[model samples]
Target: MASRRTALRPPLVSEPDLPDIVSPAAPRRSSDLRAAIIEVDGEADLAHSTLEQCVLSGSGSALDLDGATMMDVDVRDLRVAKVSARRSTLRRVRISGGRLGTLDLSDSGVHELELRDVRIDYLTLAGCKAVDVRVDSCRIAALDMPGATLSRVAFAATSSDEVDPRGMRAEHLDLRGLDALGFLDVTALRGATLTLRQVELLAPVFATAAGILISD
Candidate 1:
């Protein structure tokens, strides 16, 4: 059972209610735009603003944002055709309903990221780093964090199909209700610690590390 606060799903910004993403006479930066709904037909620069329940799209890209702030956006519903953002921060961002696909956060950065009630696949956090992260009620099919830092993270009731925990340090990487997690590159799990299920799943590898043979 969900709490009452989460039950009241907010309404999305309507197309007509949104403003033109880019205008010839439009303000130069996001700080210049004060309207709630914005629509653009070409590339535009968006710096700092409170964009709520609005749609930012363009033929090339409704909006070309460099440093923007978003909250509870319907990004998870955009699937693979969603907009691209850089140097932005997200909070309470949910990708639970979206079809799990490659999430490119290679060079991007964030303060806090939340993944809940979503489906994900092939998430690439190559160089992305976050101080705080929360993952709940989501299904992660394949996760690749070659050079990423996920400190003070919390994960509950999530499914990890293929996980590379090498070079990834988590004060606590909670995996209470998970089934299987793949091991790749073989170096990611160098210093990773696992619970009972994780140990059972990776027993062969552990045995090899200890020079003990349980099965011939």
Candidate 2:
């Protein structure tokens, strides 16, 4: 006789009533001028600058754009080992290619920042506040967002191996097209909205985190 497979029962705990999530607003084009090319090896500050088809190349602590604001910029490649923009802001900025070792935007405020077709080894947005942030068609090895606050953030057609969201707060977090393999801590997703498939995929991890045992 063949053994029968048992179906896993739904959790007995009632689902929390969550409000509707909002999508991030897309960035608006700021200018009709040609983009400027900036290729530097050390720390540079660019304020009220519009760059297009720019390529930044350097090593650790090589680029810092603190208190700088960029609009209508299209950065094609970033080859820096580590880039930090703690207090800078960007609008209608696009990053298309190149591999970044670490990109840190901690304690910064940003609106309408878009990252597409890029590869980041480690991304840190700790203690930062952002709105209308979009990441699409990218591969991130690890993401750290401790103590961060975000609104209307969306991740689409992206793959992240590990995400660490401890002490994070978010509103309207859209992960509809995310292909996440590992979440370092699922407890950080308390106030985030996910699709049905995402919930199904992460149910086991959530159960383990809640100390729920499944018996056959």
Candidate 3:
């Protein structure tokens, strides 16, 4: 008798309830916002803030969200040049239909986060601890995860130019839906679950890492 394989667990995420009436205002630095819709026209400093049941929509040149705690927040149609979200705590957050440049979530704690239909120039999760994160229908130029710890992170219908996962630790990380051009450190993908085609494509990279040269 053969042993049965375990089923992969997808990210268990829940959508936030849409508010019927929301207060419209501009974002402030280090302020507590609840049940508000923020429209950013220019640069806004939202660092050290607490946002719950809020919607952030609009275009801006820069948005700073470092050291913030966000729960049940939705970011929709937000186009920003630079987004700094380092050292933050995010729970039940969803970002959709946005274009972001330089999204840095270093040293942060993320849970139940989902990003859909978004385009990002640079996304880094350095030194961060993340769980149940899913990226779907997104385009990312560069994804760097050095020194990061991720659990149950899955990517679906997502494409990336490069991915560097050096010194990263992951469990139940599904890479089947990710179309990545190359990986910087193949050895860092020990705990990930990849498809058969991905393994065939990465054979040469693994061979080079193991000092096994192939000649035709």
Full-model lDDT for every candidate: 0.51, 0.66, 0.91
TM values, all candidates: 0.60, 0.73, 0.95
Return whichever of 1 and 2 wins on lDDT. Answer: 2
Against the true structure, candidate 2 reaches a TM-score of 0.73
lDDT of 1 at 137: 77
lDDT, candidate 3, 48-109, per-residue tens: 99998999888889999999999999999889999999999999999999899888999999
Name the better of 1 and 2 by TM-score.
2
* Residue 174 lDDT, candidate 2, scale 0-100: 68
lDDT for model 1 comes to 0.51
Clash total of candidate 3: 0
* Index of the highest-TM-score prediction: 3
Summarize candidate 2's per-residue lDDT along 1-216 as a digit string, tens digits: 111242212112111122243222212223212333455444444433333323333333356565556555555566777766666666556666777788888877766677888899998889888777888899999988898987777887999888888989877676676788878788888656677888899988999999999667
lDDT minimum window of 10 residues, candidate 3? 1-10
* Candidate number of the best lDDT: 3
RMSD of each: 8.8, 12.5, 2.8
Model 1 alpha-carbon drift over 4 Å, by segment: 1-76, 81-88, 185-193, 209-216
lDDT of 2 at 17: 24
* 1 versus 3: better lDDT goes to: 3
